[model samples]
Target: MKAAVWYGKHDVRIENKEEPVVQPGKIKIKVAWTGICGSDLHAYHGAPGVIQEGTPHPITGEMAPLTLGHEFSGIVHEIGEGVSEFAVGDRVTVEPMIKCGKCEPCKKGYSNLCDYFGFVGLQSNGGFADYVVVDDYMVHKLPDKVTLEEGALMEPAAVAFHAVKSSQMKVGSKVAVFGVGPIGLLTILCAKAAGASQIIAVDVSKERLQKAREIGATTVINGMEENAVQRILAETGGVDVAFEAAGAEVTVNNAIASIAKKGQVVIESIIPHPIKVDILQITAKEANLTATLGYCGVYKEVIAMVASGQLDVKSIITNKIVLDDLIENGFNLLTSDKSQAKIIVSPQ
Candidate 1:
């Protein structure tokens, strides 16, 4: 099996490794298509969280030299003993999260909030290879209408769906999404599908903003060209909900300032640095601030959405590369190309 292994910062090598085998209660999947996620970029740049270096991950108990890919779809190649829910050749996508089922949060149906929550690619061997093994519980069978390429996007779509579902967004309400990256663009589609009347997408990237419009955004704001917060306020008296998906301090500030009084702001990005917020402004507006982590249980819903043609997730794909070209064609291209939205890697 060939796998892309992350040894350190800016160091990813495609090396040959033994194919993973099916274990009892687990399934071996022949990886079809995988997406290069933002978290993968973070690890490539040596940002800690997913790629455990010195200390072992509490859950997977793995460290660096990790295989880096989670947003993927595959075919059921082999079933482990005691696993009868799926048969070989079933097309499926996985819920990459690994949570401690014994935790109180897990018991309360908030497994994503579990104390030792981690992801497959981040914490253990993942799908950036010819084959990967996972517990049968994490697999979700894709509908016949959804192709493997589209199923590769189910992870990120579920992320966007969960972000909107966690926010206090009412039907016909106005909303603004700062940073029209892949997740931000998907958020736009999710908001529209959820009946939002006015969707404003803010981003410095003109290409992404255009995609946002094509997807569902009623308005697009180029933050580099205009004051996003002022423009949003002057036009609509502030949106009902604002989503910060850029993971930048400026966008977070703008998301907080772009909402109306008593509005809600949902934080969807991972900001590593400590930043200041306008506490007085928040206090005066009487608004709410909520933060969402990885998705809880949105895979089935997103699969249904794709099956019904409600979300054209495949349109967001900008590039596809073979496993051999993951570094040069996939990672490097995504980091340098602003127009590139989502890139899928085929480990054939």
Candidate 2:
């Protein structure tokens, strides 16, 4: 089996390795397609401690030289002992979240908030390889209406659905999404599905903003061209809910400032560093500031939406590359081109 292994920061190499075998309570999947995530880009950019190297991950206990592809879909090649929900040749998408079921949060049905939660691709051998073995609990069967490409997007779409569902967004609520990347674009779709009346998408890239509008954003703003906050305020008074998905200091501030009084701001992106915020402004408005981590229990809903043609996950895909070209054609293309939305990696 060929796998892209991350040995260190900015050091991902494809090497042939023995295929993973099915284990008890787990299933072996022949990976069909995988998407390179922003977190993978973070690992490639010399982010310290993201890819466990010297110290092992507390939950998986897996360190560096780990395979890297979490947003993926595949065919169930082999079923492990005790697994009965799925059999051989079932097409499925994985949730890819590893959690301690005994944790207080997990006990409360909020496994995403578990104390020992770790993402599969980051902490274990992920779907980047030709074959992956994950707990049967993580598998979600894809309907006939959903293709393997759309199935590959289930993980990220789940994140978007969770973000919108977790927010205090009501019907006809005005929404703004700062950042029109895959996650941000998907967030727009989720907001629309949630019955948001107006969605304002803010991004620096014109191409992404256009794509956002095509999906469901009622309006688009190029932060690089105009004052996004002022423009948004002038157009809609102010959004009822704002989402910061750009994971940058400027966009975070813009998201906070673009909402009306008593509005809520959902921080969706992983802003790596701390920056000064206008606490007085947020306090004066009596607005709410909330943060969202990974998703929990939303895979079925997203898959249903996609299968019903309510959510077009396929439209977000811009490129497809083979596993051998993942580094150059997938990751490098994403890093260099801001216009690219989603790039799928075919592992077969």
C-alpha lDDT values of all predictions: 0.91, 0.91
- For every candidate in turn, the CA RMSD to the true structure comes to 1.0, 1.0
lDDT of 2 at 219: 90
Q: For candidate 1, report its TM-score.
A: 0.98
For candidate 1, write residues 207-325 as lDDT tens digits.
99889898889999998899999999999999999999999888888999989999999999888879888867678899998889989988888899999998889988988999999
Worst-scoring 10-residue span by lDDT in model 2: 48-57
Clashing residue pairs in all predictions, respectively, total 0, 0
Task: Extract clashing residue pairs from model 2.
Answer: none
Per-residue C-alpha lDDT of model 2 across residues 34-69, encoded as one tens digit per residue:
988999988888787566677678777887789998
lDDT of 1 at 126: 89
Where in model 1 is the C-alpha error above 4 Å? Answer: none
